[model samples]
Structure formats: structure tokens, C-alpha cells
Target: MQAAKKPVTFYLGEEVAMLKLQDLKAEAQSSWETLNLLDGTELTAEAFQVVMRKFGDLRHRSTWERICIQLEALWLLKGLENCDLIRTLAAPDTPIAQAYPAELLDAVLAHPSGLAQVKNGLQQLYSDPLTESDRICAMQFLKRISGYETIDLDLPEISLQAA
Candidate 1:
């Protein structure tokens, strides 16, 4: 495949971050290639830590949209192991936090503990702006993964009263 033609630029106020956007792109490419060749099912703690750190850093950057676009292009998850990305980024107030929250919810939904965790998180998003965003995401997850439906039943019966 051809390399991306446009270069990613950042608005730096002081000392630039250690990892460049291109570096993260390279990591994604490497991950894609690795997953295609000899994909492993388990996430090593070191690697996990590295990925988490990158994501944590990403959440705080002003270049979040660009970075997330690159990541989305690069992150073609191989299996449950790669679900870590989705899990970690599912919640929190960040540009990339809401990026692909629902994309791999199915992976966790398949696991009992993971599913419970997601359910609890959904419940906890009560009144914040992110709540509606996250709730929409959770609803979408249920809909796509299964033929499930989300209903808002304020009153027990279907009373078609005009507001």
C-alpha cells in the first residue's frame, strides 16, 4: 500500500510530545501487519501498557481528531485481544474517547464479566452530556450485535399524547 501523502502537523505551544503522529501511524501499520501474519490471542502487559499510554496521551492532545482518524484507519482488530483498545476508550471525556466506543462492544458483550462491566458503565452515565453520547453508543452496540431494541418507557402504556 502507498504511504499517506499528507503529513500530520500539530499546534505546539511549548515542548512537543515525545511521540509524533507519524509514530502512532507506524505503530498502527505494524499492528495491522502483525495481526495479519501471526496474530496472538493474548496481550502482553508491557505491550498493553504501551498502547494504553499512547491512548492516554492521545486523549489529552489538541490533535485528537487527526490522531483518531489515523488510528481508525490503522486499527483493524484481529480478535478479542485487540478489544482492549475499544474497552479502554469506551468511556471518559476525550476527543477519541467517543470515537469508536460502539465499534467493538460485541467483543466484550460476548464475555460475562466484560458485558457486566459495560452494562454498569452505561447505567452510570446518568446526567452528563457524555451520558447521552455514551448511552447512544451503548444502544447502537446492542442493536448491531444482536437484533435488540432500546425503548424509552416513561409511562407503562403507549399513550400518544402530544407534548
Candidate 2:
């Protein structure tokens, strides 16, 4: 018999969203794989060039940083399951190199716009019917930009489980 599934919850203040962890994991993995395949899974030179060209505007720094942070978290969360595959796709020199300003990241994390963008982006990715890869990229993009310390670790154990 199949094992009982684990429940996943995302809580924001009084709001709570529920889902199956197993299903979410599967979707995340599929999305990562698709992204890797599309870009040759190597973060190749061409890929980096493309990324730099596309995200060259420093004016949108907040958006860029938020996306990166989300992506990093998603990578950490989902990549842990398939170490080898994740490693290959997440080479160090990717276009998502250290682009966010330290000061900006701090400000964004502390500001409402940063949090709202991340929350909205995640909600859209989770709810939309897009391929897992697009979702993974979207999350990765957010993670790369948002400040690391912004992730509240002081929350109860249950609160940390969903994200």
C-alpha cells in the first residue's frame, strides 16, 4: 500500500493554505528538470549571456533580487531530493551570479514591496497551471534577489514546514 501523504500548509498571519507535500515536491522537481533541459542544464556561457542581457536593467533591482532569493530557496528545498541532478544544473557561474546589492536586499526585505512581490509571485506560481520548470525559474529568480535574513526563522516549527 502507498504510504500516507504528508500535508503541507502555508500560513500568513491568520490565513492558511493547505496542500500535499508529495505532490508539490513532484511538481517542483518536474519544473526544475524542464528548466535544466531547456538551458542545457549547465548554466552554460550562452545561458549566462542571455540572462545578463535580459536582466541588465539595474532599475528593477528589487524585482531581480526577490526572484533570486525565491529561486535559491526553491533550489534548496527541491534540489535536496536529487542531489546529482541539482548539482549539474546549478553551476556556480550562472547568470544569477551575485547581482543584488547588499544594501538593497536589506531594504527590500524590510520593505512591504519586497514581501508583497515574493508572496504574490509564489502564490501565482503555486496556483497557476504552468509547467513546473517555469515555476522553479520564477521562484529561483525571486530567491536570488530577496535578502536571506528576511526569511523569518523564529516562527514555530509548523510554520516553516510549508515554504
TM-score of each: 0.27, 0.25
Q: Encode model 2's per-residue lDDT on 14-131: one tens digit a residue.
A: 2223323343333334444545655467645565445434534524544344445444444433343322222222222222222223432354345434444444445444345267
Model 2, position 153: C-alpha lDDT score: 24
For 58-161, candidate 1 gives per-residue lDDT tens digits of 44543443434444423423232222333343332322223333432443454445544444444443222254565555444345445556645221212223
Per-residue error for 134 in candidate 2, Å, reads 2.3
- lDDT of all the models against the reference? 0.41, 0.39
Q: What range of 10 consecutive residues in model 2 has the weakest lDDT sum?
A: 152-161
